[model samples]
Target: MDADLLKTFLAVIRQGSFVGAAEQVGRTQSAVSQQIQRLEGLVGGPLLVRTSRAIRLTVAGERFVEYAQRLVDLADEAKRAVHGLAVQRTLRVGIVEDLAGFALAEILRRLHDEAPSLQLEIHSASTRELLPLLGFRYDVVIGMKPLASRGGVELSRLSLCWLGEWQGGPVPLALHPDGCGMRQAAIQALDAAGIDWRAAIVADGILPNIAIVRAGLAVTVLADALCPADLPRSQGLPALQPLSLRLFAHEEADRQATETLGRIISETLGAAVC
Candidate 1:
């Protein structure tokens, strides 16, 4: 019945765990668990089955999800209408540098065409640096899902490919600095395959690494979507696991605006991968 409780319930569902939901809602895990318990009590049944691996909705919870979302949306709409709050005019978006190429251009073009009056601010960084700023500094963030964590709506799962030509002897690699999920995957795969590699260039963002690859100085790991057509995918290398692209919207962000951006991003990236 309470909109806040419903919102928290949705956060848990979206985030896939109480800990992730707490991070998304800016609450402690204990508080999130308590809120879920209160919501379950109000609904007169258990809503979730929690396990160490995942959180699954009960049949009652599955049936209630749509109504809960509707109630929360109506509540937000009612508050805005009653209070005469101005529609949100600015959207701050953060994206990983890897996706800042054609994918970003298409996404921005669509967003502007649909919401012409809305102002936009964009930041490009590595996934490691973008996630932390999701709620506090940006209204929405598009980044790679961390290997160990679960949260955010998935936009696409892209196969990781080795880009650029591979010359002989001690494989040269241009990688993003420490914290990058792709870099970690590349290193682990190489080590596991017993291949010798040298970090020819260590950069903070994707552009420099891309440049290195372009110059044929080193090979880099990137999503298949972001790999340049001219830069060939290496024939012999350890296959890396697919990386998931995810969208994170701040819990307190303007619902309409965030949803619009999220939809455009999903459609744009989803189509690109397909």
Candidate 2:
């Protein structure tokens, strides 16, 4: 009857195994198993029948799951009733591709540890895509502050800086795929300085960009605090001015996921770079 027990059981059912349930709940497998055992003891019945590779819900357990899910959901609803969280379920979040490395890892880790219920649909795109989506498509998104959104949104300031590979070779440049905000910015800086640049000979998601810098392929922009320390970097011909990234954060009415996601992002990213 304990709400936490039912929550644990439900997590196990959703994930199909203790290991997955543990990861989902941010607990060890043994800890998850103990919770199930406690639930069985409380209910005076076994909830699962286990074989070598499979664990099936017992008849009573199967019947119990429906009510358990409802009960846990009701508890969540009750929490929302008095103190509601973000309302969106399938929260589509947009992140700049460059932040995916150091910035995003901290964000996701904190989110996983804190907000376990928010099923995040994270999309990486350039500022071009994320800006409009924040206004119309996604529930809550992260992006650069759009010029036109001034009246409608608020922003958190972040410092962005340009970096380059230090190798004696041609100015190696790392860029997000076409249509990315960082790519446009880097191009602008290069054009202004009249420094010829080349595409990222190696490119991929946020993490790969960091790897590229470490590998001496090219330089990419990142939050000043979050820049990788191991890379051989230079400011190049004329020093590229540091950029202050204004993270546009929107709170949506449809999804409660935002509160949790925000919590995770704040905890993880807030401390990571600095």
Candidate 3:
């Protein structure tokens, strides 16, 4: 089987649409469709069910997911065994939006400084979305969550703070779209305190949220390390619980390789908290 075709199949599963998968894999949408068709033809059955709203794996695809990962992992390991850590390999990483925006550059820089031939493919989403992508789609994830049942190394405790100018009307909020842990935390805290608030802006990624807060259009929750020094931390808003920055590795990921990457990421981001 063509490894590229398998990669395309996995991308479609993770991305949920031909368009999204194409963007991720650097192919045209029609090319992605053709690749999927080729893969299905080779497999002798349909692998995915395309709905109007979302894509789902067929039973075959569901069963194939694990095998696909093993094949990819084995290929990566074989190459690295011959060429060492400096071998060119792509590391699939998922990170919550805030950490991606705030510290991803430094982390990547450190990784490259240590291992120049390593390449990274990063997916930035909320913790809700990122967690599910682990073990199958992504090799590792950095999230803001308590170090509870899920085993991961806690990099630091980030103080959650509100950033914006004081407003007279219903507290204007700039937040991520639904399912973000940070957005949920802010909303829950406001609701518990009986404070009226409205989402003045909803941003899918980190920069736009920060821009909204900087423009004074709305208040947004951010980690103290993430908040710009120029932005004033708003008072009179409900207090927010701190977030634990953690690094979670996929069960099937190359542990030795990922541990090295994780340590680099932690060291880079943890210094900000210090």
Measured by lDDT, the strongest candidate is: 1
Superposed by TM-score, candidate 3 places the C-alpha of residue 203 at a distance from the truth, in angstroms, of: 2.5
TM-score of each predicted structure versus truth: 0.64, 0.49, 0.62
Clashing pairs counted in every model: 0, 9, 0
**lDDT values for all models:** 0.85, 0.66, 0.82
The residue pairs in collision within model 2 are 86-255, 86-256, 87-254, 87-255, 87-256, 88-254, 88-255, 88-256, 160-243
Task: List, residue by residue over 27-143, the lDDT tens digit for candidate 2.
Answer: 999999999999999888999987889789999998898899899888888888765345324566777655564577767767766666556777776566676777466666665
Descending-lDDT candidate ranking: 1, 3, 2
Best by TM-score: 1
- Model 2 spans > 4 angstroms off: 1-90, 108-119, 131-137, 145-155, 167-170, 200-204, 235-237, 241-252, 255-274
Residue pairs in candidate 3 whose N, alpha carbon or C atoms collide under 3 angstroms: none
Residue-level lDDT tens digits of model 1 in 84-151: 53654887889887788748888889988998767778898877888888888898888986445598
Error of 3 at 256 (Å): 1.9
Model 1: which ten-residue window has the lowest total lDDT?
82-91
Instruction: Report each candidate's C-alpha RMSD, comma-separated, in the order given.
Output: 22.5, 15.5, 21.0
Assess candidate 3 and give its TM-score to the true structure: 0.62
